[model samples]
Target chain A: MKKRLFTPGPTPVPEEVMLRMAAPIIHHRNPEFMEILARVHENLRYLFQTTQPVVALSCSGTGGMEAAVSSLFGEGDKVITVNAGKFGERWTELVQLYTGSSTEETLPWGSAITPERLKQLLKEHPDAKGICLTHSETSTGTASDIKTLSAVIREHSEALVLVDGITAIGAHEFHFDDWGIDICITGSQKGLMMPPGLALVAISERAQERINEPARKPSNYYLSLKKALESHAGDDTPFTPAVSLVIGLDEALTMIRSEGIEHVWKRHESLAAACRAGCIALGMKIFSSSPSFAVTPVWLPEGADWTEFNDALKHDNGITVAAGQDAFKGKIFRISHLGYYDELDMLTVIGAIERAMKAIGLPLTPGTGVTAVQKAFLGK
Target chain B: MKKRLFTPGPTPVPEEVMLRMAAPIIHHRNPEFMEILARVHENLRYLFQTTQPVVALSCSGTGGMEAAVSSLFGEGDKVITVNAGKFGERWTELVQLYTGSSTEETLPWGSAITPERLKQLLKEHPDAKGICLTHSETSTGTASDIKTLSAVIREHSEALVLVDGITAIGAHEFHFDDWGIDICITGSQKGLMMPPGLALVAISERAQERINEPARKPSNYYLSLKKALESHAGDDTPFTPAVSLVIGLDEALTMIRSEGIEHVWKRHESLAAACRAGCIALGMKIFSSSPSFAVTPVWLPEGADWTEFNDALKHDNGITVAAGQDAFKGKIFRISHLGYYDELDMLTVIGAIERAMKAIGLPLTPGTGVTAVQKAFLGK
Candidate 1:
């Protein structure tokens, strides 16, 4: 089978990067790996759009969020987490678990948290120590306007802003320093065009200062930012790192740099627009009102069997789109154009979804979705 | 230069496994990856020689140790850590950092913890909540008799036995269930013949019960074994695991099962003996009295410059051996036979060392070390 990936994360790795990682393993302590680490450090900062150090952790994107909560927030510290999707809910869970307290600013899964509502939440909880939210929520295919939201927080409280940029950094337009984000986390599989297992965390100076606060002792050791920072200063990791992933990350970052960050964002924007147009042409409603460029979710028809449609897409067309998670499971299918994606890739997926929908007896005109995708992709 | 690896942790990975990993990555949530995970789970138990579940975490070995401490031990719990070398020192650090109370049973770096001494320590710390130690300390090339030490702890104290088996499990003889060990952690790069990202932790029934105790709240979310075990029942992980690494591990474990665990141990034993004999012929003192079969450390000649010798070995012979860590740095060199090593490989490394020693102006017979390695490998 041809096996095409349209999952949010683990989208697709470049073949060159995969081959580079498969070369014989190198010693972490050796000079060669240290040189690689140095390049990875500099290049990762470029990817995050930050001047402050970005530490690469050997875990999933969720671990990066865990590190932020455990390292910066002390016991009983009040924080605000926006719950619009699964990842946003994770922030609430992690902050509540670590700090024993959190104030939630929640919305429907497909709804975005506006700066106005965030301002009201900050007004209610004026003493919040931190503000946590996901820039792009994978499960809901929604993206919060972090720049405006961070500006609102800056006007209201001194709360440090933490953003989960897992599906946002490479695909979405981000200005970490300009937007005043204290901490931002991204996963390798999403924006970095590598396999899972490595997470890059960008910490601003204010967040580092909060982490070093005497009152906020590090409750967790494995994901401690203080230790990572100290080691990262020397281009080394606190523990043995995921070396092959980091090496792959270097190549990935280099590819991103060569493509130009603005062009990367433009490509994602075009692909996302095409996907939404194609789904609309298929008579399927887009799931999110505030959709992210990383993924596009479409509602299943009223009587369509999700399993049968999924089988047609996966088995027949070799296309694997992500099934909805949490409350939306088996209700919607998500198509990702997150990494290493182009206009033709988006058109191919739309064609597959169209075929699958027709196979499941869902009302759809032949060539409608593909034609819409072509028109959108070509800006006609 | 054609390169060879002899690092204690990151020993060479098989070409077949590397090629498998290099193939386009499959989605971790897919049925294909699930089948691979199932096979990995079964083979991992066989490698650990335990009936209990072995959970894989997406981090280095230190993260695995952190998981054990945070999951199984409560705050202010009294624990005892034995410090014989670098890894043992890490145990002291981790336990102290987590529990804030640890009694030390210190030994010289190269000395093993005898059964009598361990018994005395257990008797003194009878109220200890946990007993933490390392099976093989890589820094000083020391290996403790874990079976005897566990027996002593079982007899004298009710404390849980936690073992860091990073460089010990596949190379040395281990009886996890029979030894009454509560927790044992190892990394993929060590005796597992894989890369460095994944860590496998074997947890016994008692340890799982300890984790379930009302007072033992998990302080960590990322490395939480409780979450891991719950997910493991369904043949899944709580987080996006290192998918490529798991697939590679599946193949690596299959190779181990084919070789038979006893033969694997015997191969390591043979390589260790050969390495020790070759070093002896070079008039170098073995660094440890109770050295591990995983790696052998040898003292450098009085006038030999460590950097020059290393350069000769690496640049001239394409053999990369580990430099001594901690207090022994610049004084000794370490040669690892932990994973994927044969007697011929041992002889090749010995020849490299002899040539390097000669390059550094140290007096040595050219073929003496190789001859000794051949004799010891043949058990003559």
Candidate 2:
């Protein structure tokens, strides 16, 4: 079977990057390896659209989130966390775990937090130390307006703005310095088009000041952002890093740079638009009102079992799409058009979904979805 | 240039494992991925030589060491850490960071700690909560007698025995259950013949009890062993794991199982013996008196610059060997006989080293090292 990955993360890694990583591993401390790290550092800054130092740690995306919470704020420091999806809930959880005093501004899943609400929250919580936001919520396939939200926080509050750009940075246009974001975190498996195990965090000088505050004490030893920045300045890591993954990331980033970030974002946008058009033509409702360009979520048709639909797509068509998480499970299915995806790949996924839906006895016009996807790709 | 990796940790990944990892990425929560994890769990227990559950974390080997310390003990608890090399020093550092009180037993870089010394330390620190040992110190190519040391700790004290078997478990013979080791940690890149991302830690029932103790308050949020174990029960990880690395590891473990553990150890032993014989034939002294089968450290000749030798080997021959770390740097170079390495590979490395030595004006008979390696392989 020809298996295809259409998940939000662990997207299809480019063959060039895979082959680059498959080469013989190099010692991390060697000058050769350090040269690779130096290239990766420069490319990471370019990808993040920031002049600040971006450090890579050998852990998952959640590790980066934890590092932000542990390093920037001390005990009793109140943080305002937005909870709009599974990842947003993680921010709330991390803040509660690390700070013990955080205000969770909750919103229903699949809905974006408005800048006005953020302004109101900031007005209410004047002592808030930071505001955690999700640039693109992977679980719900919705992207919050980071630029607007960060602008609101910058205008209204002294709190540092932290954005989880796990699935957003490469797929969308994210200007860290322009938006005045203090911290931006991403994972290697998502927009970077590589395997997991690396959390790349871009920290601004404002965040560094908080980390270097003499009065602030952090409990974390491994994921210390201060130490990570210190070592990264020397093109090294505090510990033995995931050397092969970094090599893979360097290749992936180089590919992205060659393709141009704007082109990458435009490709994602077009692919996502085609997917949404296909879903609408099939008479299925898009799950998120403000869907992200990284992934497209659609509610299953009436009397459709999401489990059976996704399983048929996997077993019969050799396609793997993600089922909705938490309360949304069994009700929605998501198709990712993030990395290494094109209009042709999107058409293939839509064809598979159409076949699976018909196999599940869902009423759908034959060739409707594929035709719509082709029309969208043709800009009809 | 045809490159070769002969470092200890980032040892050569087998071609099959590399190709497997190079395949399209899969979602971590997908059924296909869970199936891979289930198979990895069974094979990890086999490789660790234990019936206990082995959980995989998406971090380096050092993360596993930190988890063992943070999860099992609280502040002010005393741990006896052995510092014989760079990795052993990490244990002392972690213990002091997590637990305020710890006894560090320092030894010469290449020398192994004796059972009598451990017994005396245990007697002196009667309230010690744990004993940390390095099964194979990669920096010096020294393999400590873990079985004898664990037995001594078991007989003389109630401290939990923790072994950093990063370069030991698959390359050498280690019986976790038989040796009564409480916690054993290994990395993906060393004996596992994979890239550096995943950390495999085998935990015993004793350690689980200590983790579950109500009085235990772990400060770490990401690398929590107790939470990791809970998720592993369902064949999952607490965070997004290194999915491609896990796939690579699955293939590597399958290869190990097919070869049989005993045969694997024998191969490493023979390869290391061949390397040692080759070095001796070239009039070079082995650096570690208690050298590990995973790697062979050789002292550079008097007045010879190790940097120039290694650089020539890398540039001219496309071979990558490790220079000694810290105090041993420039004094010695290491040749790894670990995973994905055989007698032929050892001969090739020895030939390259001889050529580089001759290029550096060192006196050596032509083909002396290669002939010695061939003779050692023939048991002559």
Candidate 3:
């Protein structure tokens, strides 16, 4: 049975993108690959909505996070990460491992961090060198106001605003330049709608200048941004790239560009809205008060075994969704509407949930979820 | 033009393997992906010649190197690394980054670290937790004697032997169990005949025990071997894997197994013999006195401009071989015979080199290189 992906990432890949990935392998140093490499850079710049050069790496989004910490700040330098969810907490971990230990402003689980809090914290800290935040917290399905948060960081003058935009870039509206973001990182598997193994780092000129400054700690050999940039300027990576995945991403980015940026965001917005409405009509509550357009976390109704519900949906209906992480595990589930998704797919997910709930003796009409989703789609 | 790749890595991927990689995307956590992941683990065991579970990561071979350092040794722990070539030097860098420091027994460039030297070092530094060496140093084309080096470490009974087999495993003979190699790390792009995404680590139970001992330093979020093994038991990865590349490696391993492990090593041995004979017949000197069977690094004859030779080969004959790295730059070039290459490919590479050299006024007899390679292949 062919299953549909409604998980936050490693999302459904377009056939065109898949074929592009399956294309013949080429030498990364060859002129042919150089052309593809240059194209990937250009496409990433367009997706980031910035003129800053985007560096492509053959590691996961975590590697991009590591790069941000290892390159921008030296050992023992003070930094702050907005810990709103699992990813935000990971920012603190990466900072501890790569740069110096970090200070974290953590929100309660299933909550979003506010720009006002960040403004107050940074002003108090005064000497912090960088501020890190997750633009879309996939773990909790909460989206932060990165644009406003970055503005606050810019006002602080000493700190650079770095964003982990792994699940936000294509599905949400992020103008890297307009937001005054210094370092924006994303992965190919998430909103980019490609396979895993490529991490993109879009570094502003200001960030680049900071990275070039001498730091106390020794830089990582593979994650050295300066070396990567020097090699990238000649249309080559500092290391062997995931060549096929780069091809996949180039093709996927072209599709996103063709769909138009605003339209892409609107597509995610409508899908998320419909899915959330369907869940509410099924007598469920949304997990986060303020949710992201990428995914909607929903609380399972009382006495509903989320593990059993997830298994039934996967085994019976061939529908794969995301279960909750950390303490929320087995209490909440997530429905993703980002990356190669449509209204029809959203409806299919709703239909599966409806079937699973009715089979488990939960109260539901035959097409109650479907009717609510349709109404939401039509703005009725 | 179709280009032939003889680089140390990002080697020529076989068409069948490419097709496997091009397979329709599957959910990594689904049954389909579980089956594929299981096959990857099983076949990797066969390739590593060990029964211990192997872990695959969606990172470069360098990541595997880092995993070896960060997992077994904590920060401030003493370790030993052999610096014979670029890859060995990389091990030094990783140790410094993850473990905070290590002692390196420097071997002169283009020279192998003799077993006696390793024994001497271990005896001098009994406090060392592990010993690191590259089985095949791609930069210098030097092959270390893993059997003798492991014997030296096993004599100590305390220090584990870590071998960086990134370019050696399938092409060269390695017995992880028989040779007592505690940690053998490799990449899919080398002798595996696949794209660059997956890094394979085969660790002995003894190495796992070392990791189990609590250290003061915390484990890395991405390179956490403990977390990875917990997920591996269920045939799943903790993070999003490079799914298509895993499929390609599975298929490539199947081919290798079907061919028989001994026969694969025999093929590489014969191909390497032919390559060396061809180079010598063309009056080029071998770079490493004890050459690695995976790649042959050869010094250009006097006054031969390496840049012109490589460019003509790539542009005129559509042959892309590897240039030397670091201090060896322009002084030598490498010809890899690791994956997806046979006598015919070797003949083509040697023939192209002869033509390129002749066109650039380097001395070479007509049909000299070809006849030598043919004779070696024919065992005449």
TM-score, cand. 1: 0.99
Worst 10 residues of 2 chain A by lDDT: A214-223
lDDT to native, each model:
0.90, 0.90, 0.85
**2 or 3, greater by TM-score:** 2
Rank list by DockQ: 1, 2, 3
Candidates' DockQ values?
A: 0.81, 0.68, 0.53
What number of backbone clashes does candidate 3 have, counting pairs of residues 3 or more apart or in separate chains? 0
Best by TM-score: 1
Off by over 4 Å in 3: A74-76, A98-102, A233-235, A301-304, A358-362, A378-380, B74-76, B98-102, B301-304, B354-367
The DockQ of predicted model 1 stands at: 0.81
Clashing pairs in 2: none
Could you give the fnat of all candidates in order?
Answer: 0.75, 0.79, 0.54
Candidate 2 local lDDT, B285-323, one digit each (tens): 998879999999889866689878987799999888888
TM-score of chain A of 1: 0.98
TM-score of each model, paired residue for residue: 0.99, 0.96, 0.93
The ten-residue window of minimal lDDT in model 3 chain B covers B215-224
Task: Compute the interface RMSD for each candidate structure.
Answer: 1.0, 1.4, 2.1
> For model 2, how does the per-residue alpha-carbon lDDT over A1-380 read when each residue is reduced to its tens digit?
99898988888899899889888677887888999999999999999999999999999999999999999987698999999899999898888877776799889988999988888898899888899999999999999989888988999989999999999989888998999999999999899999888999999999999998888755777888988988998999998899889999999999999999999999998899999999999889999989999999889867888778877899999998888899998998889988888789988999998899889999978899999999998866
- Docking class for model 1 is high
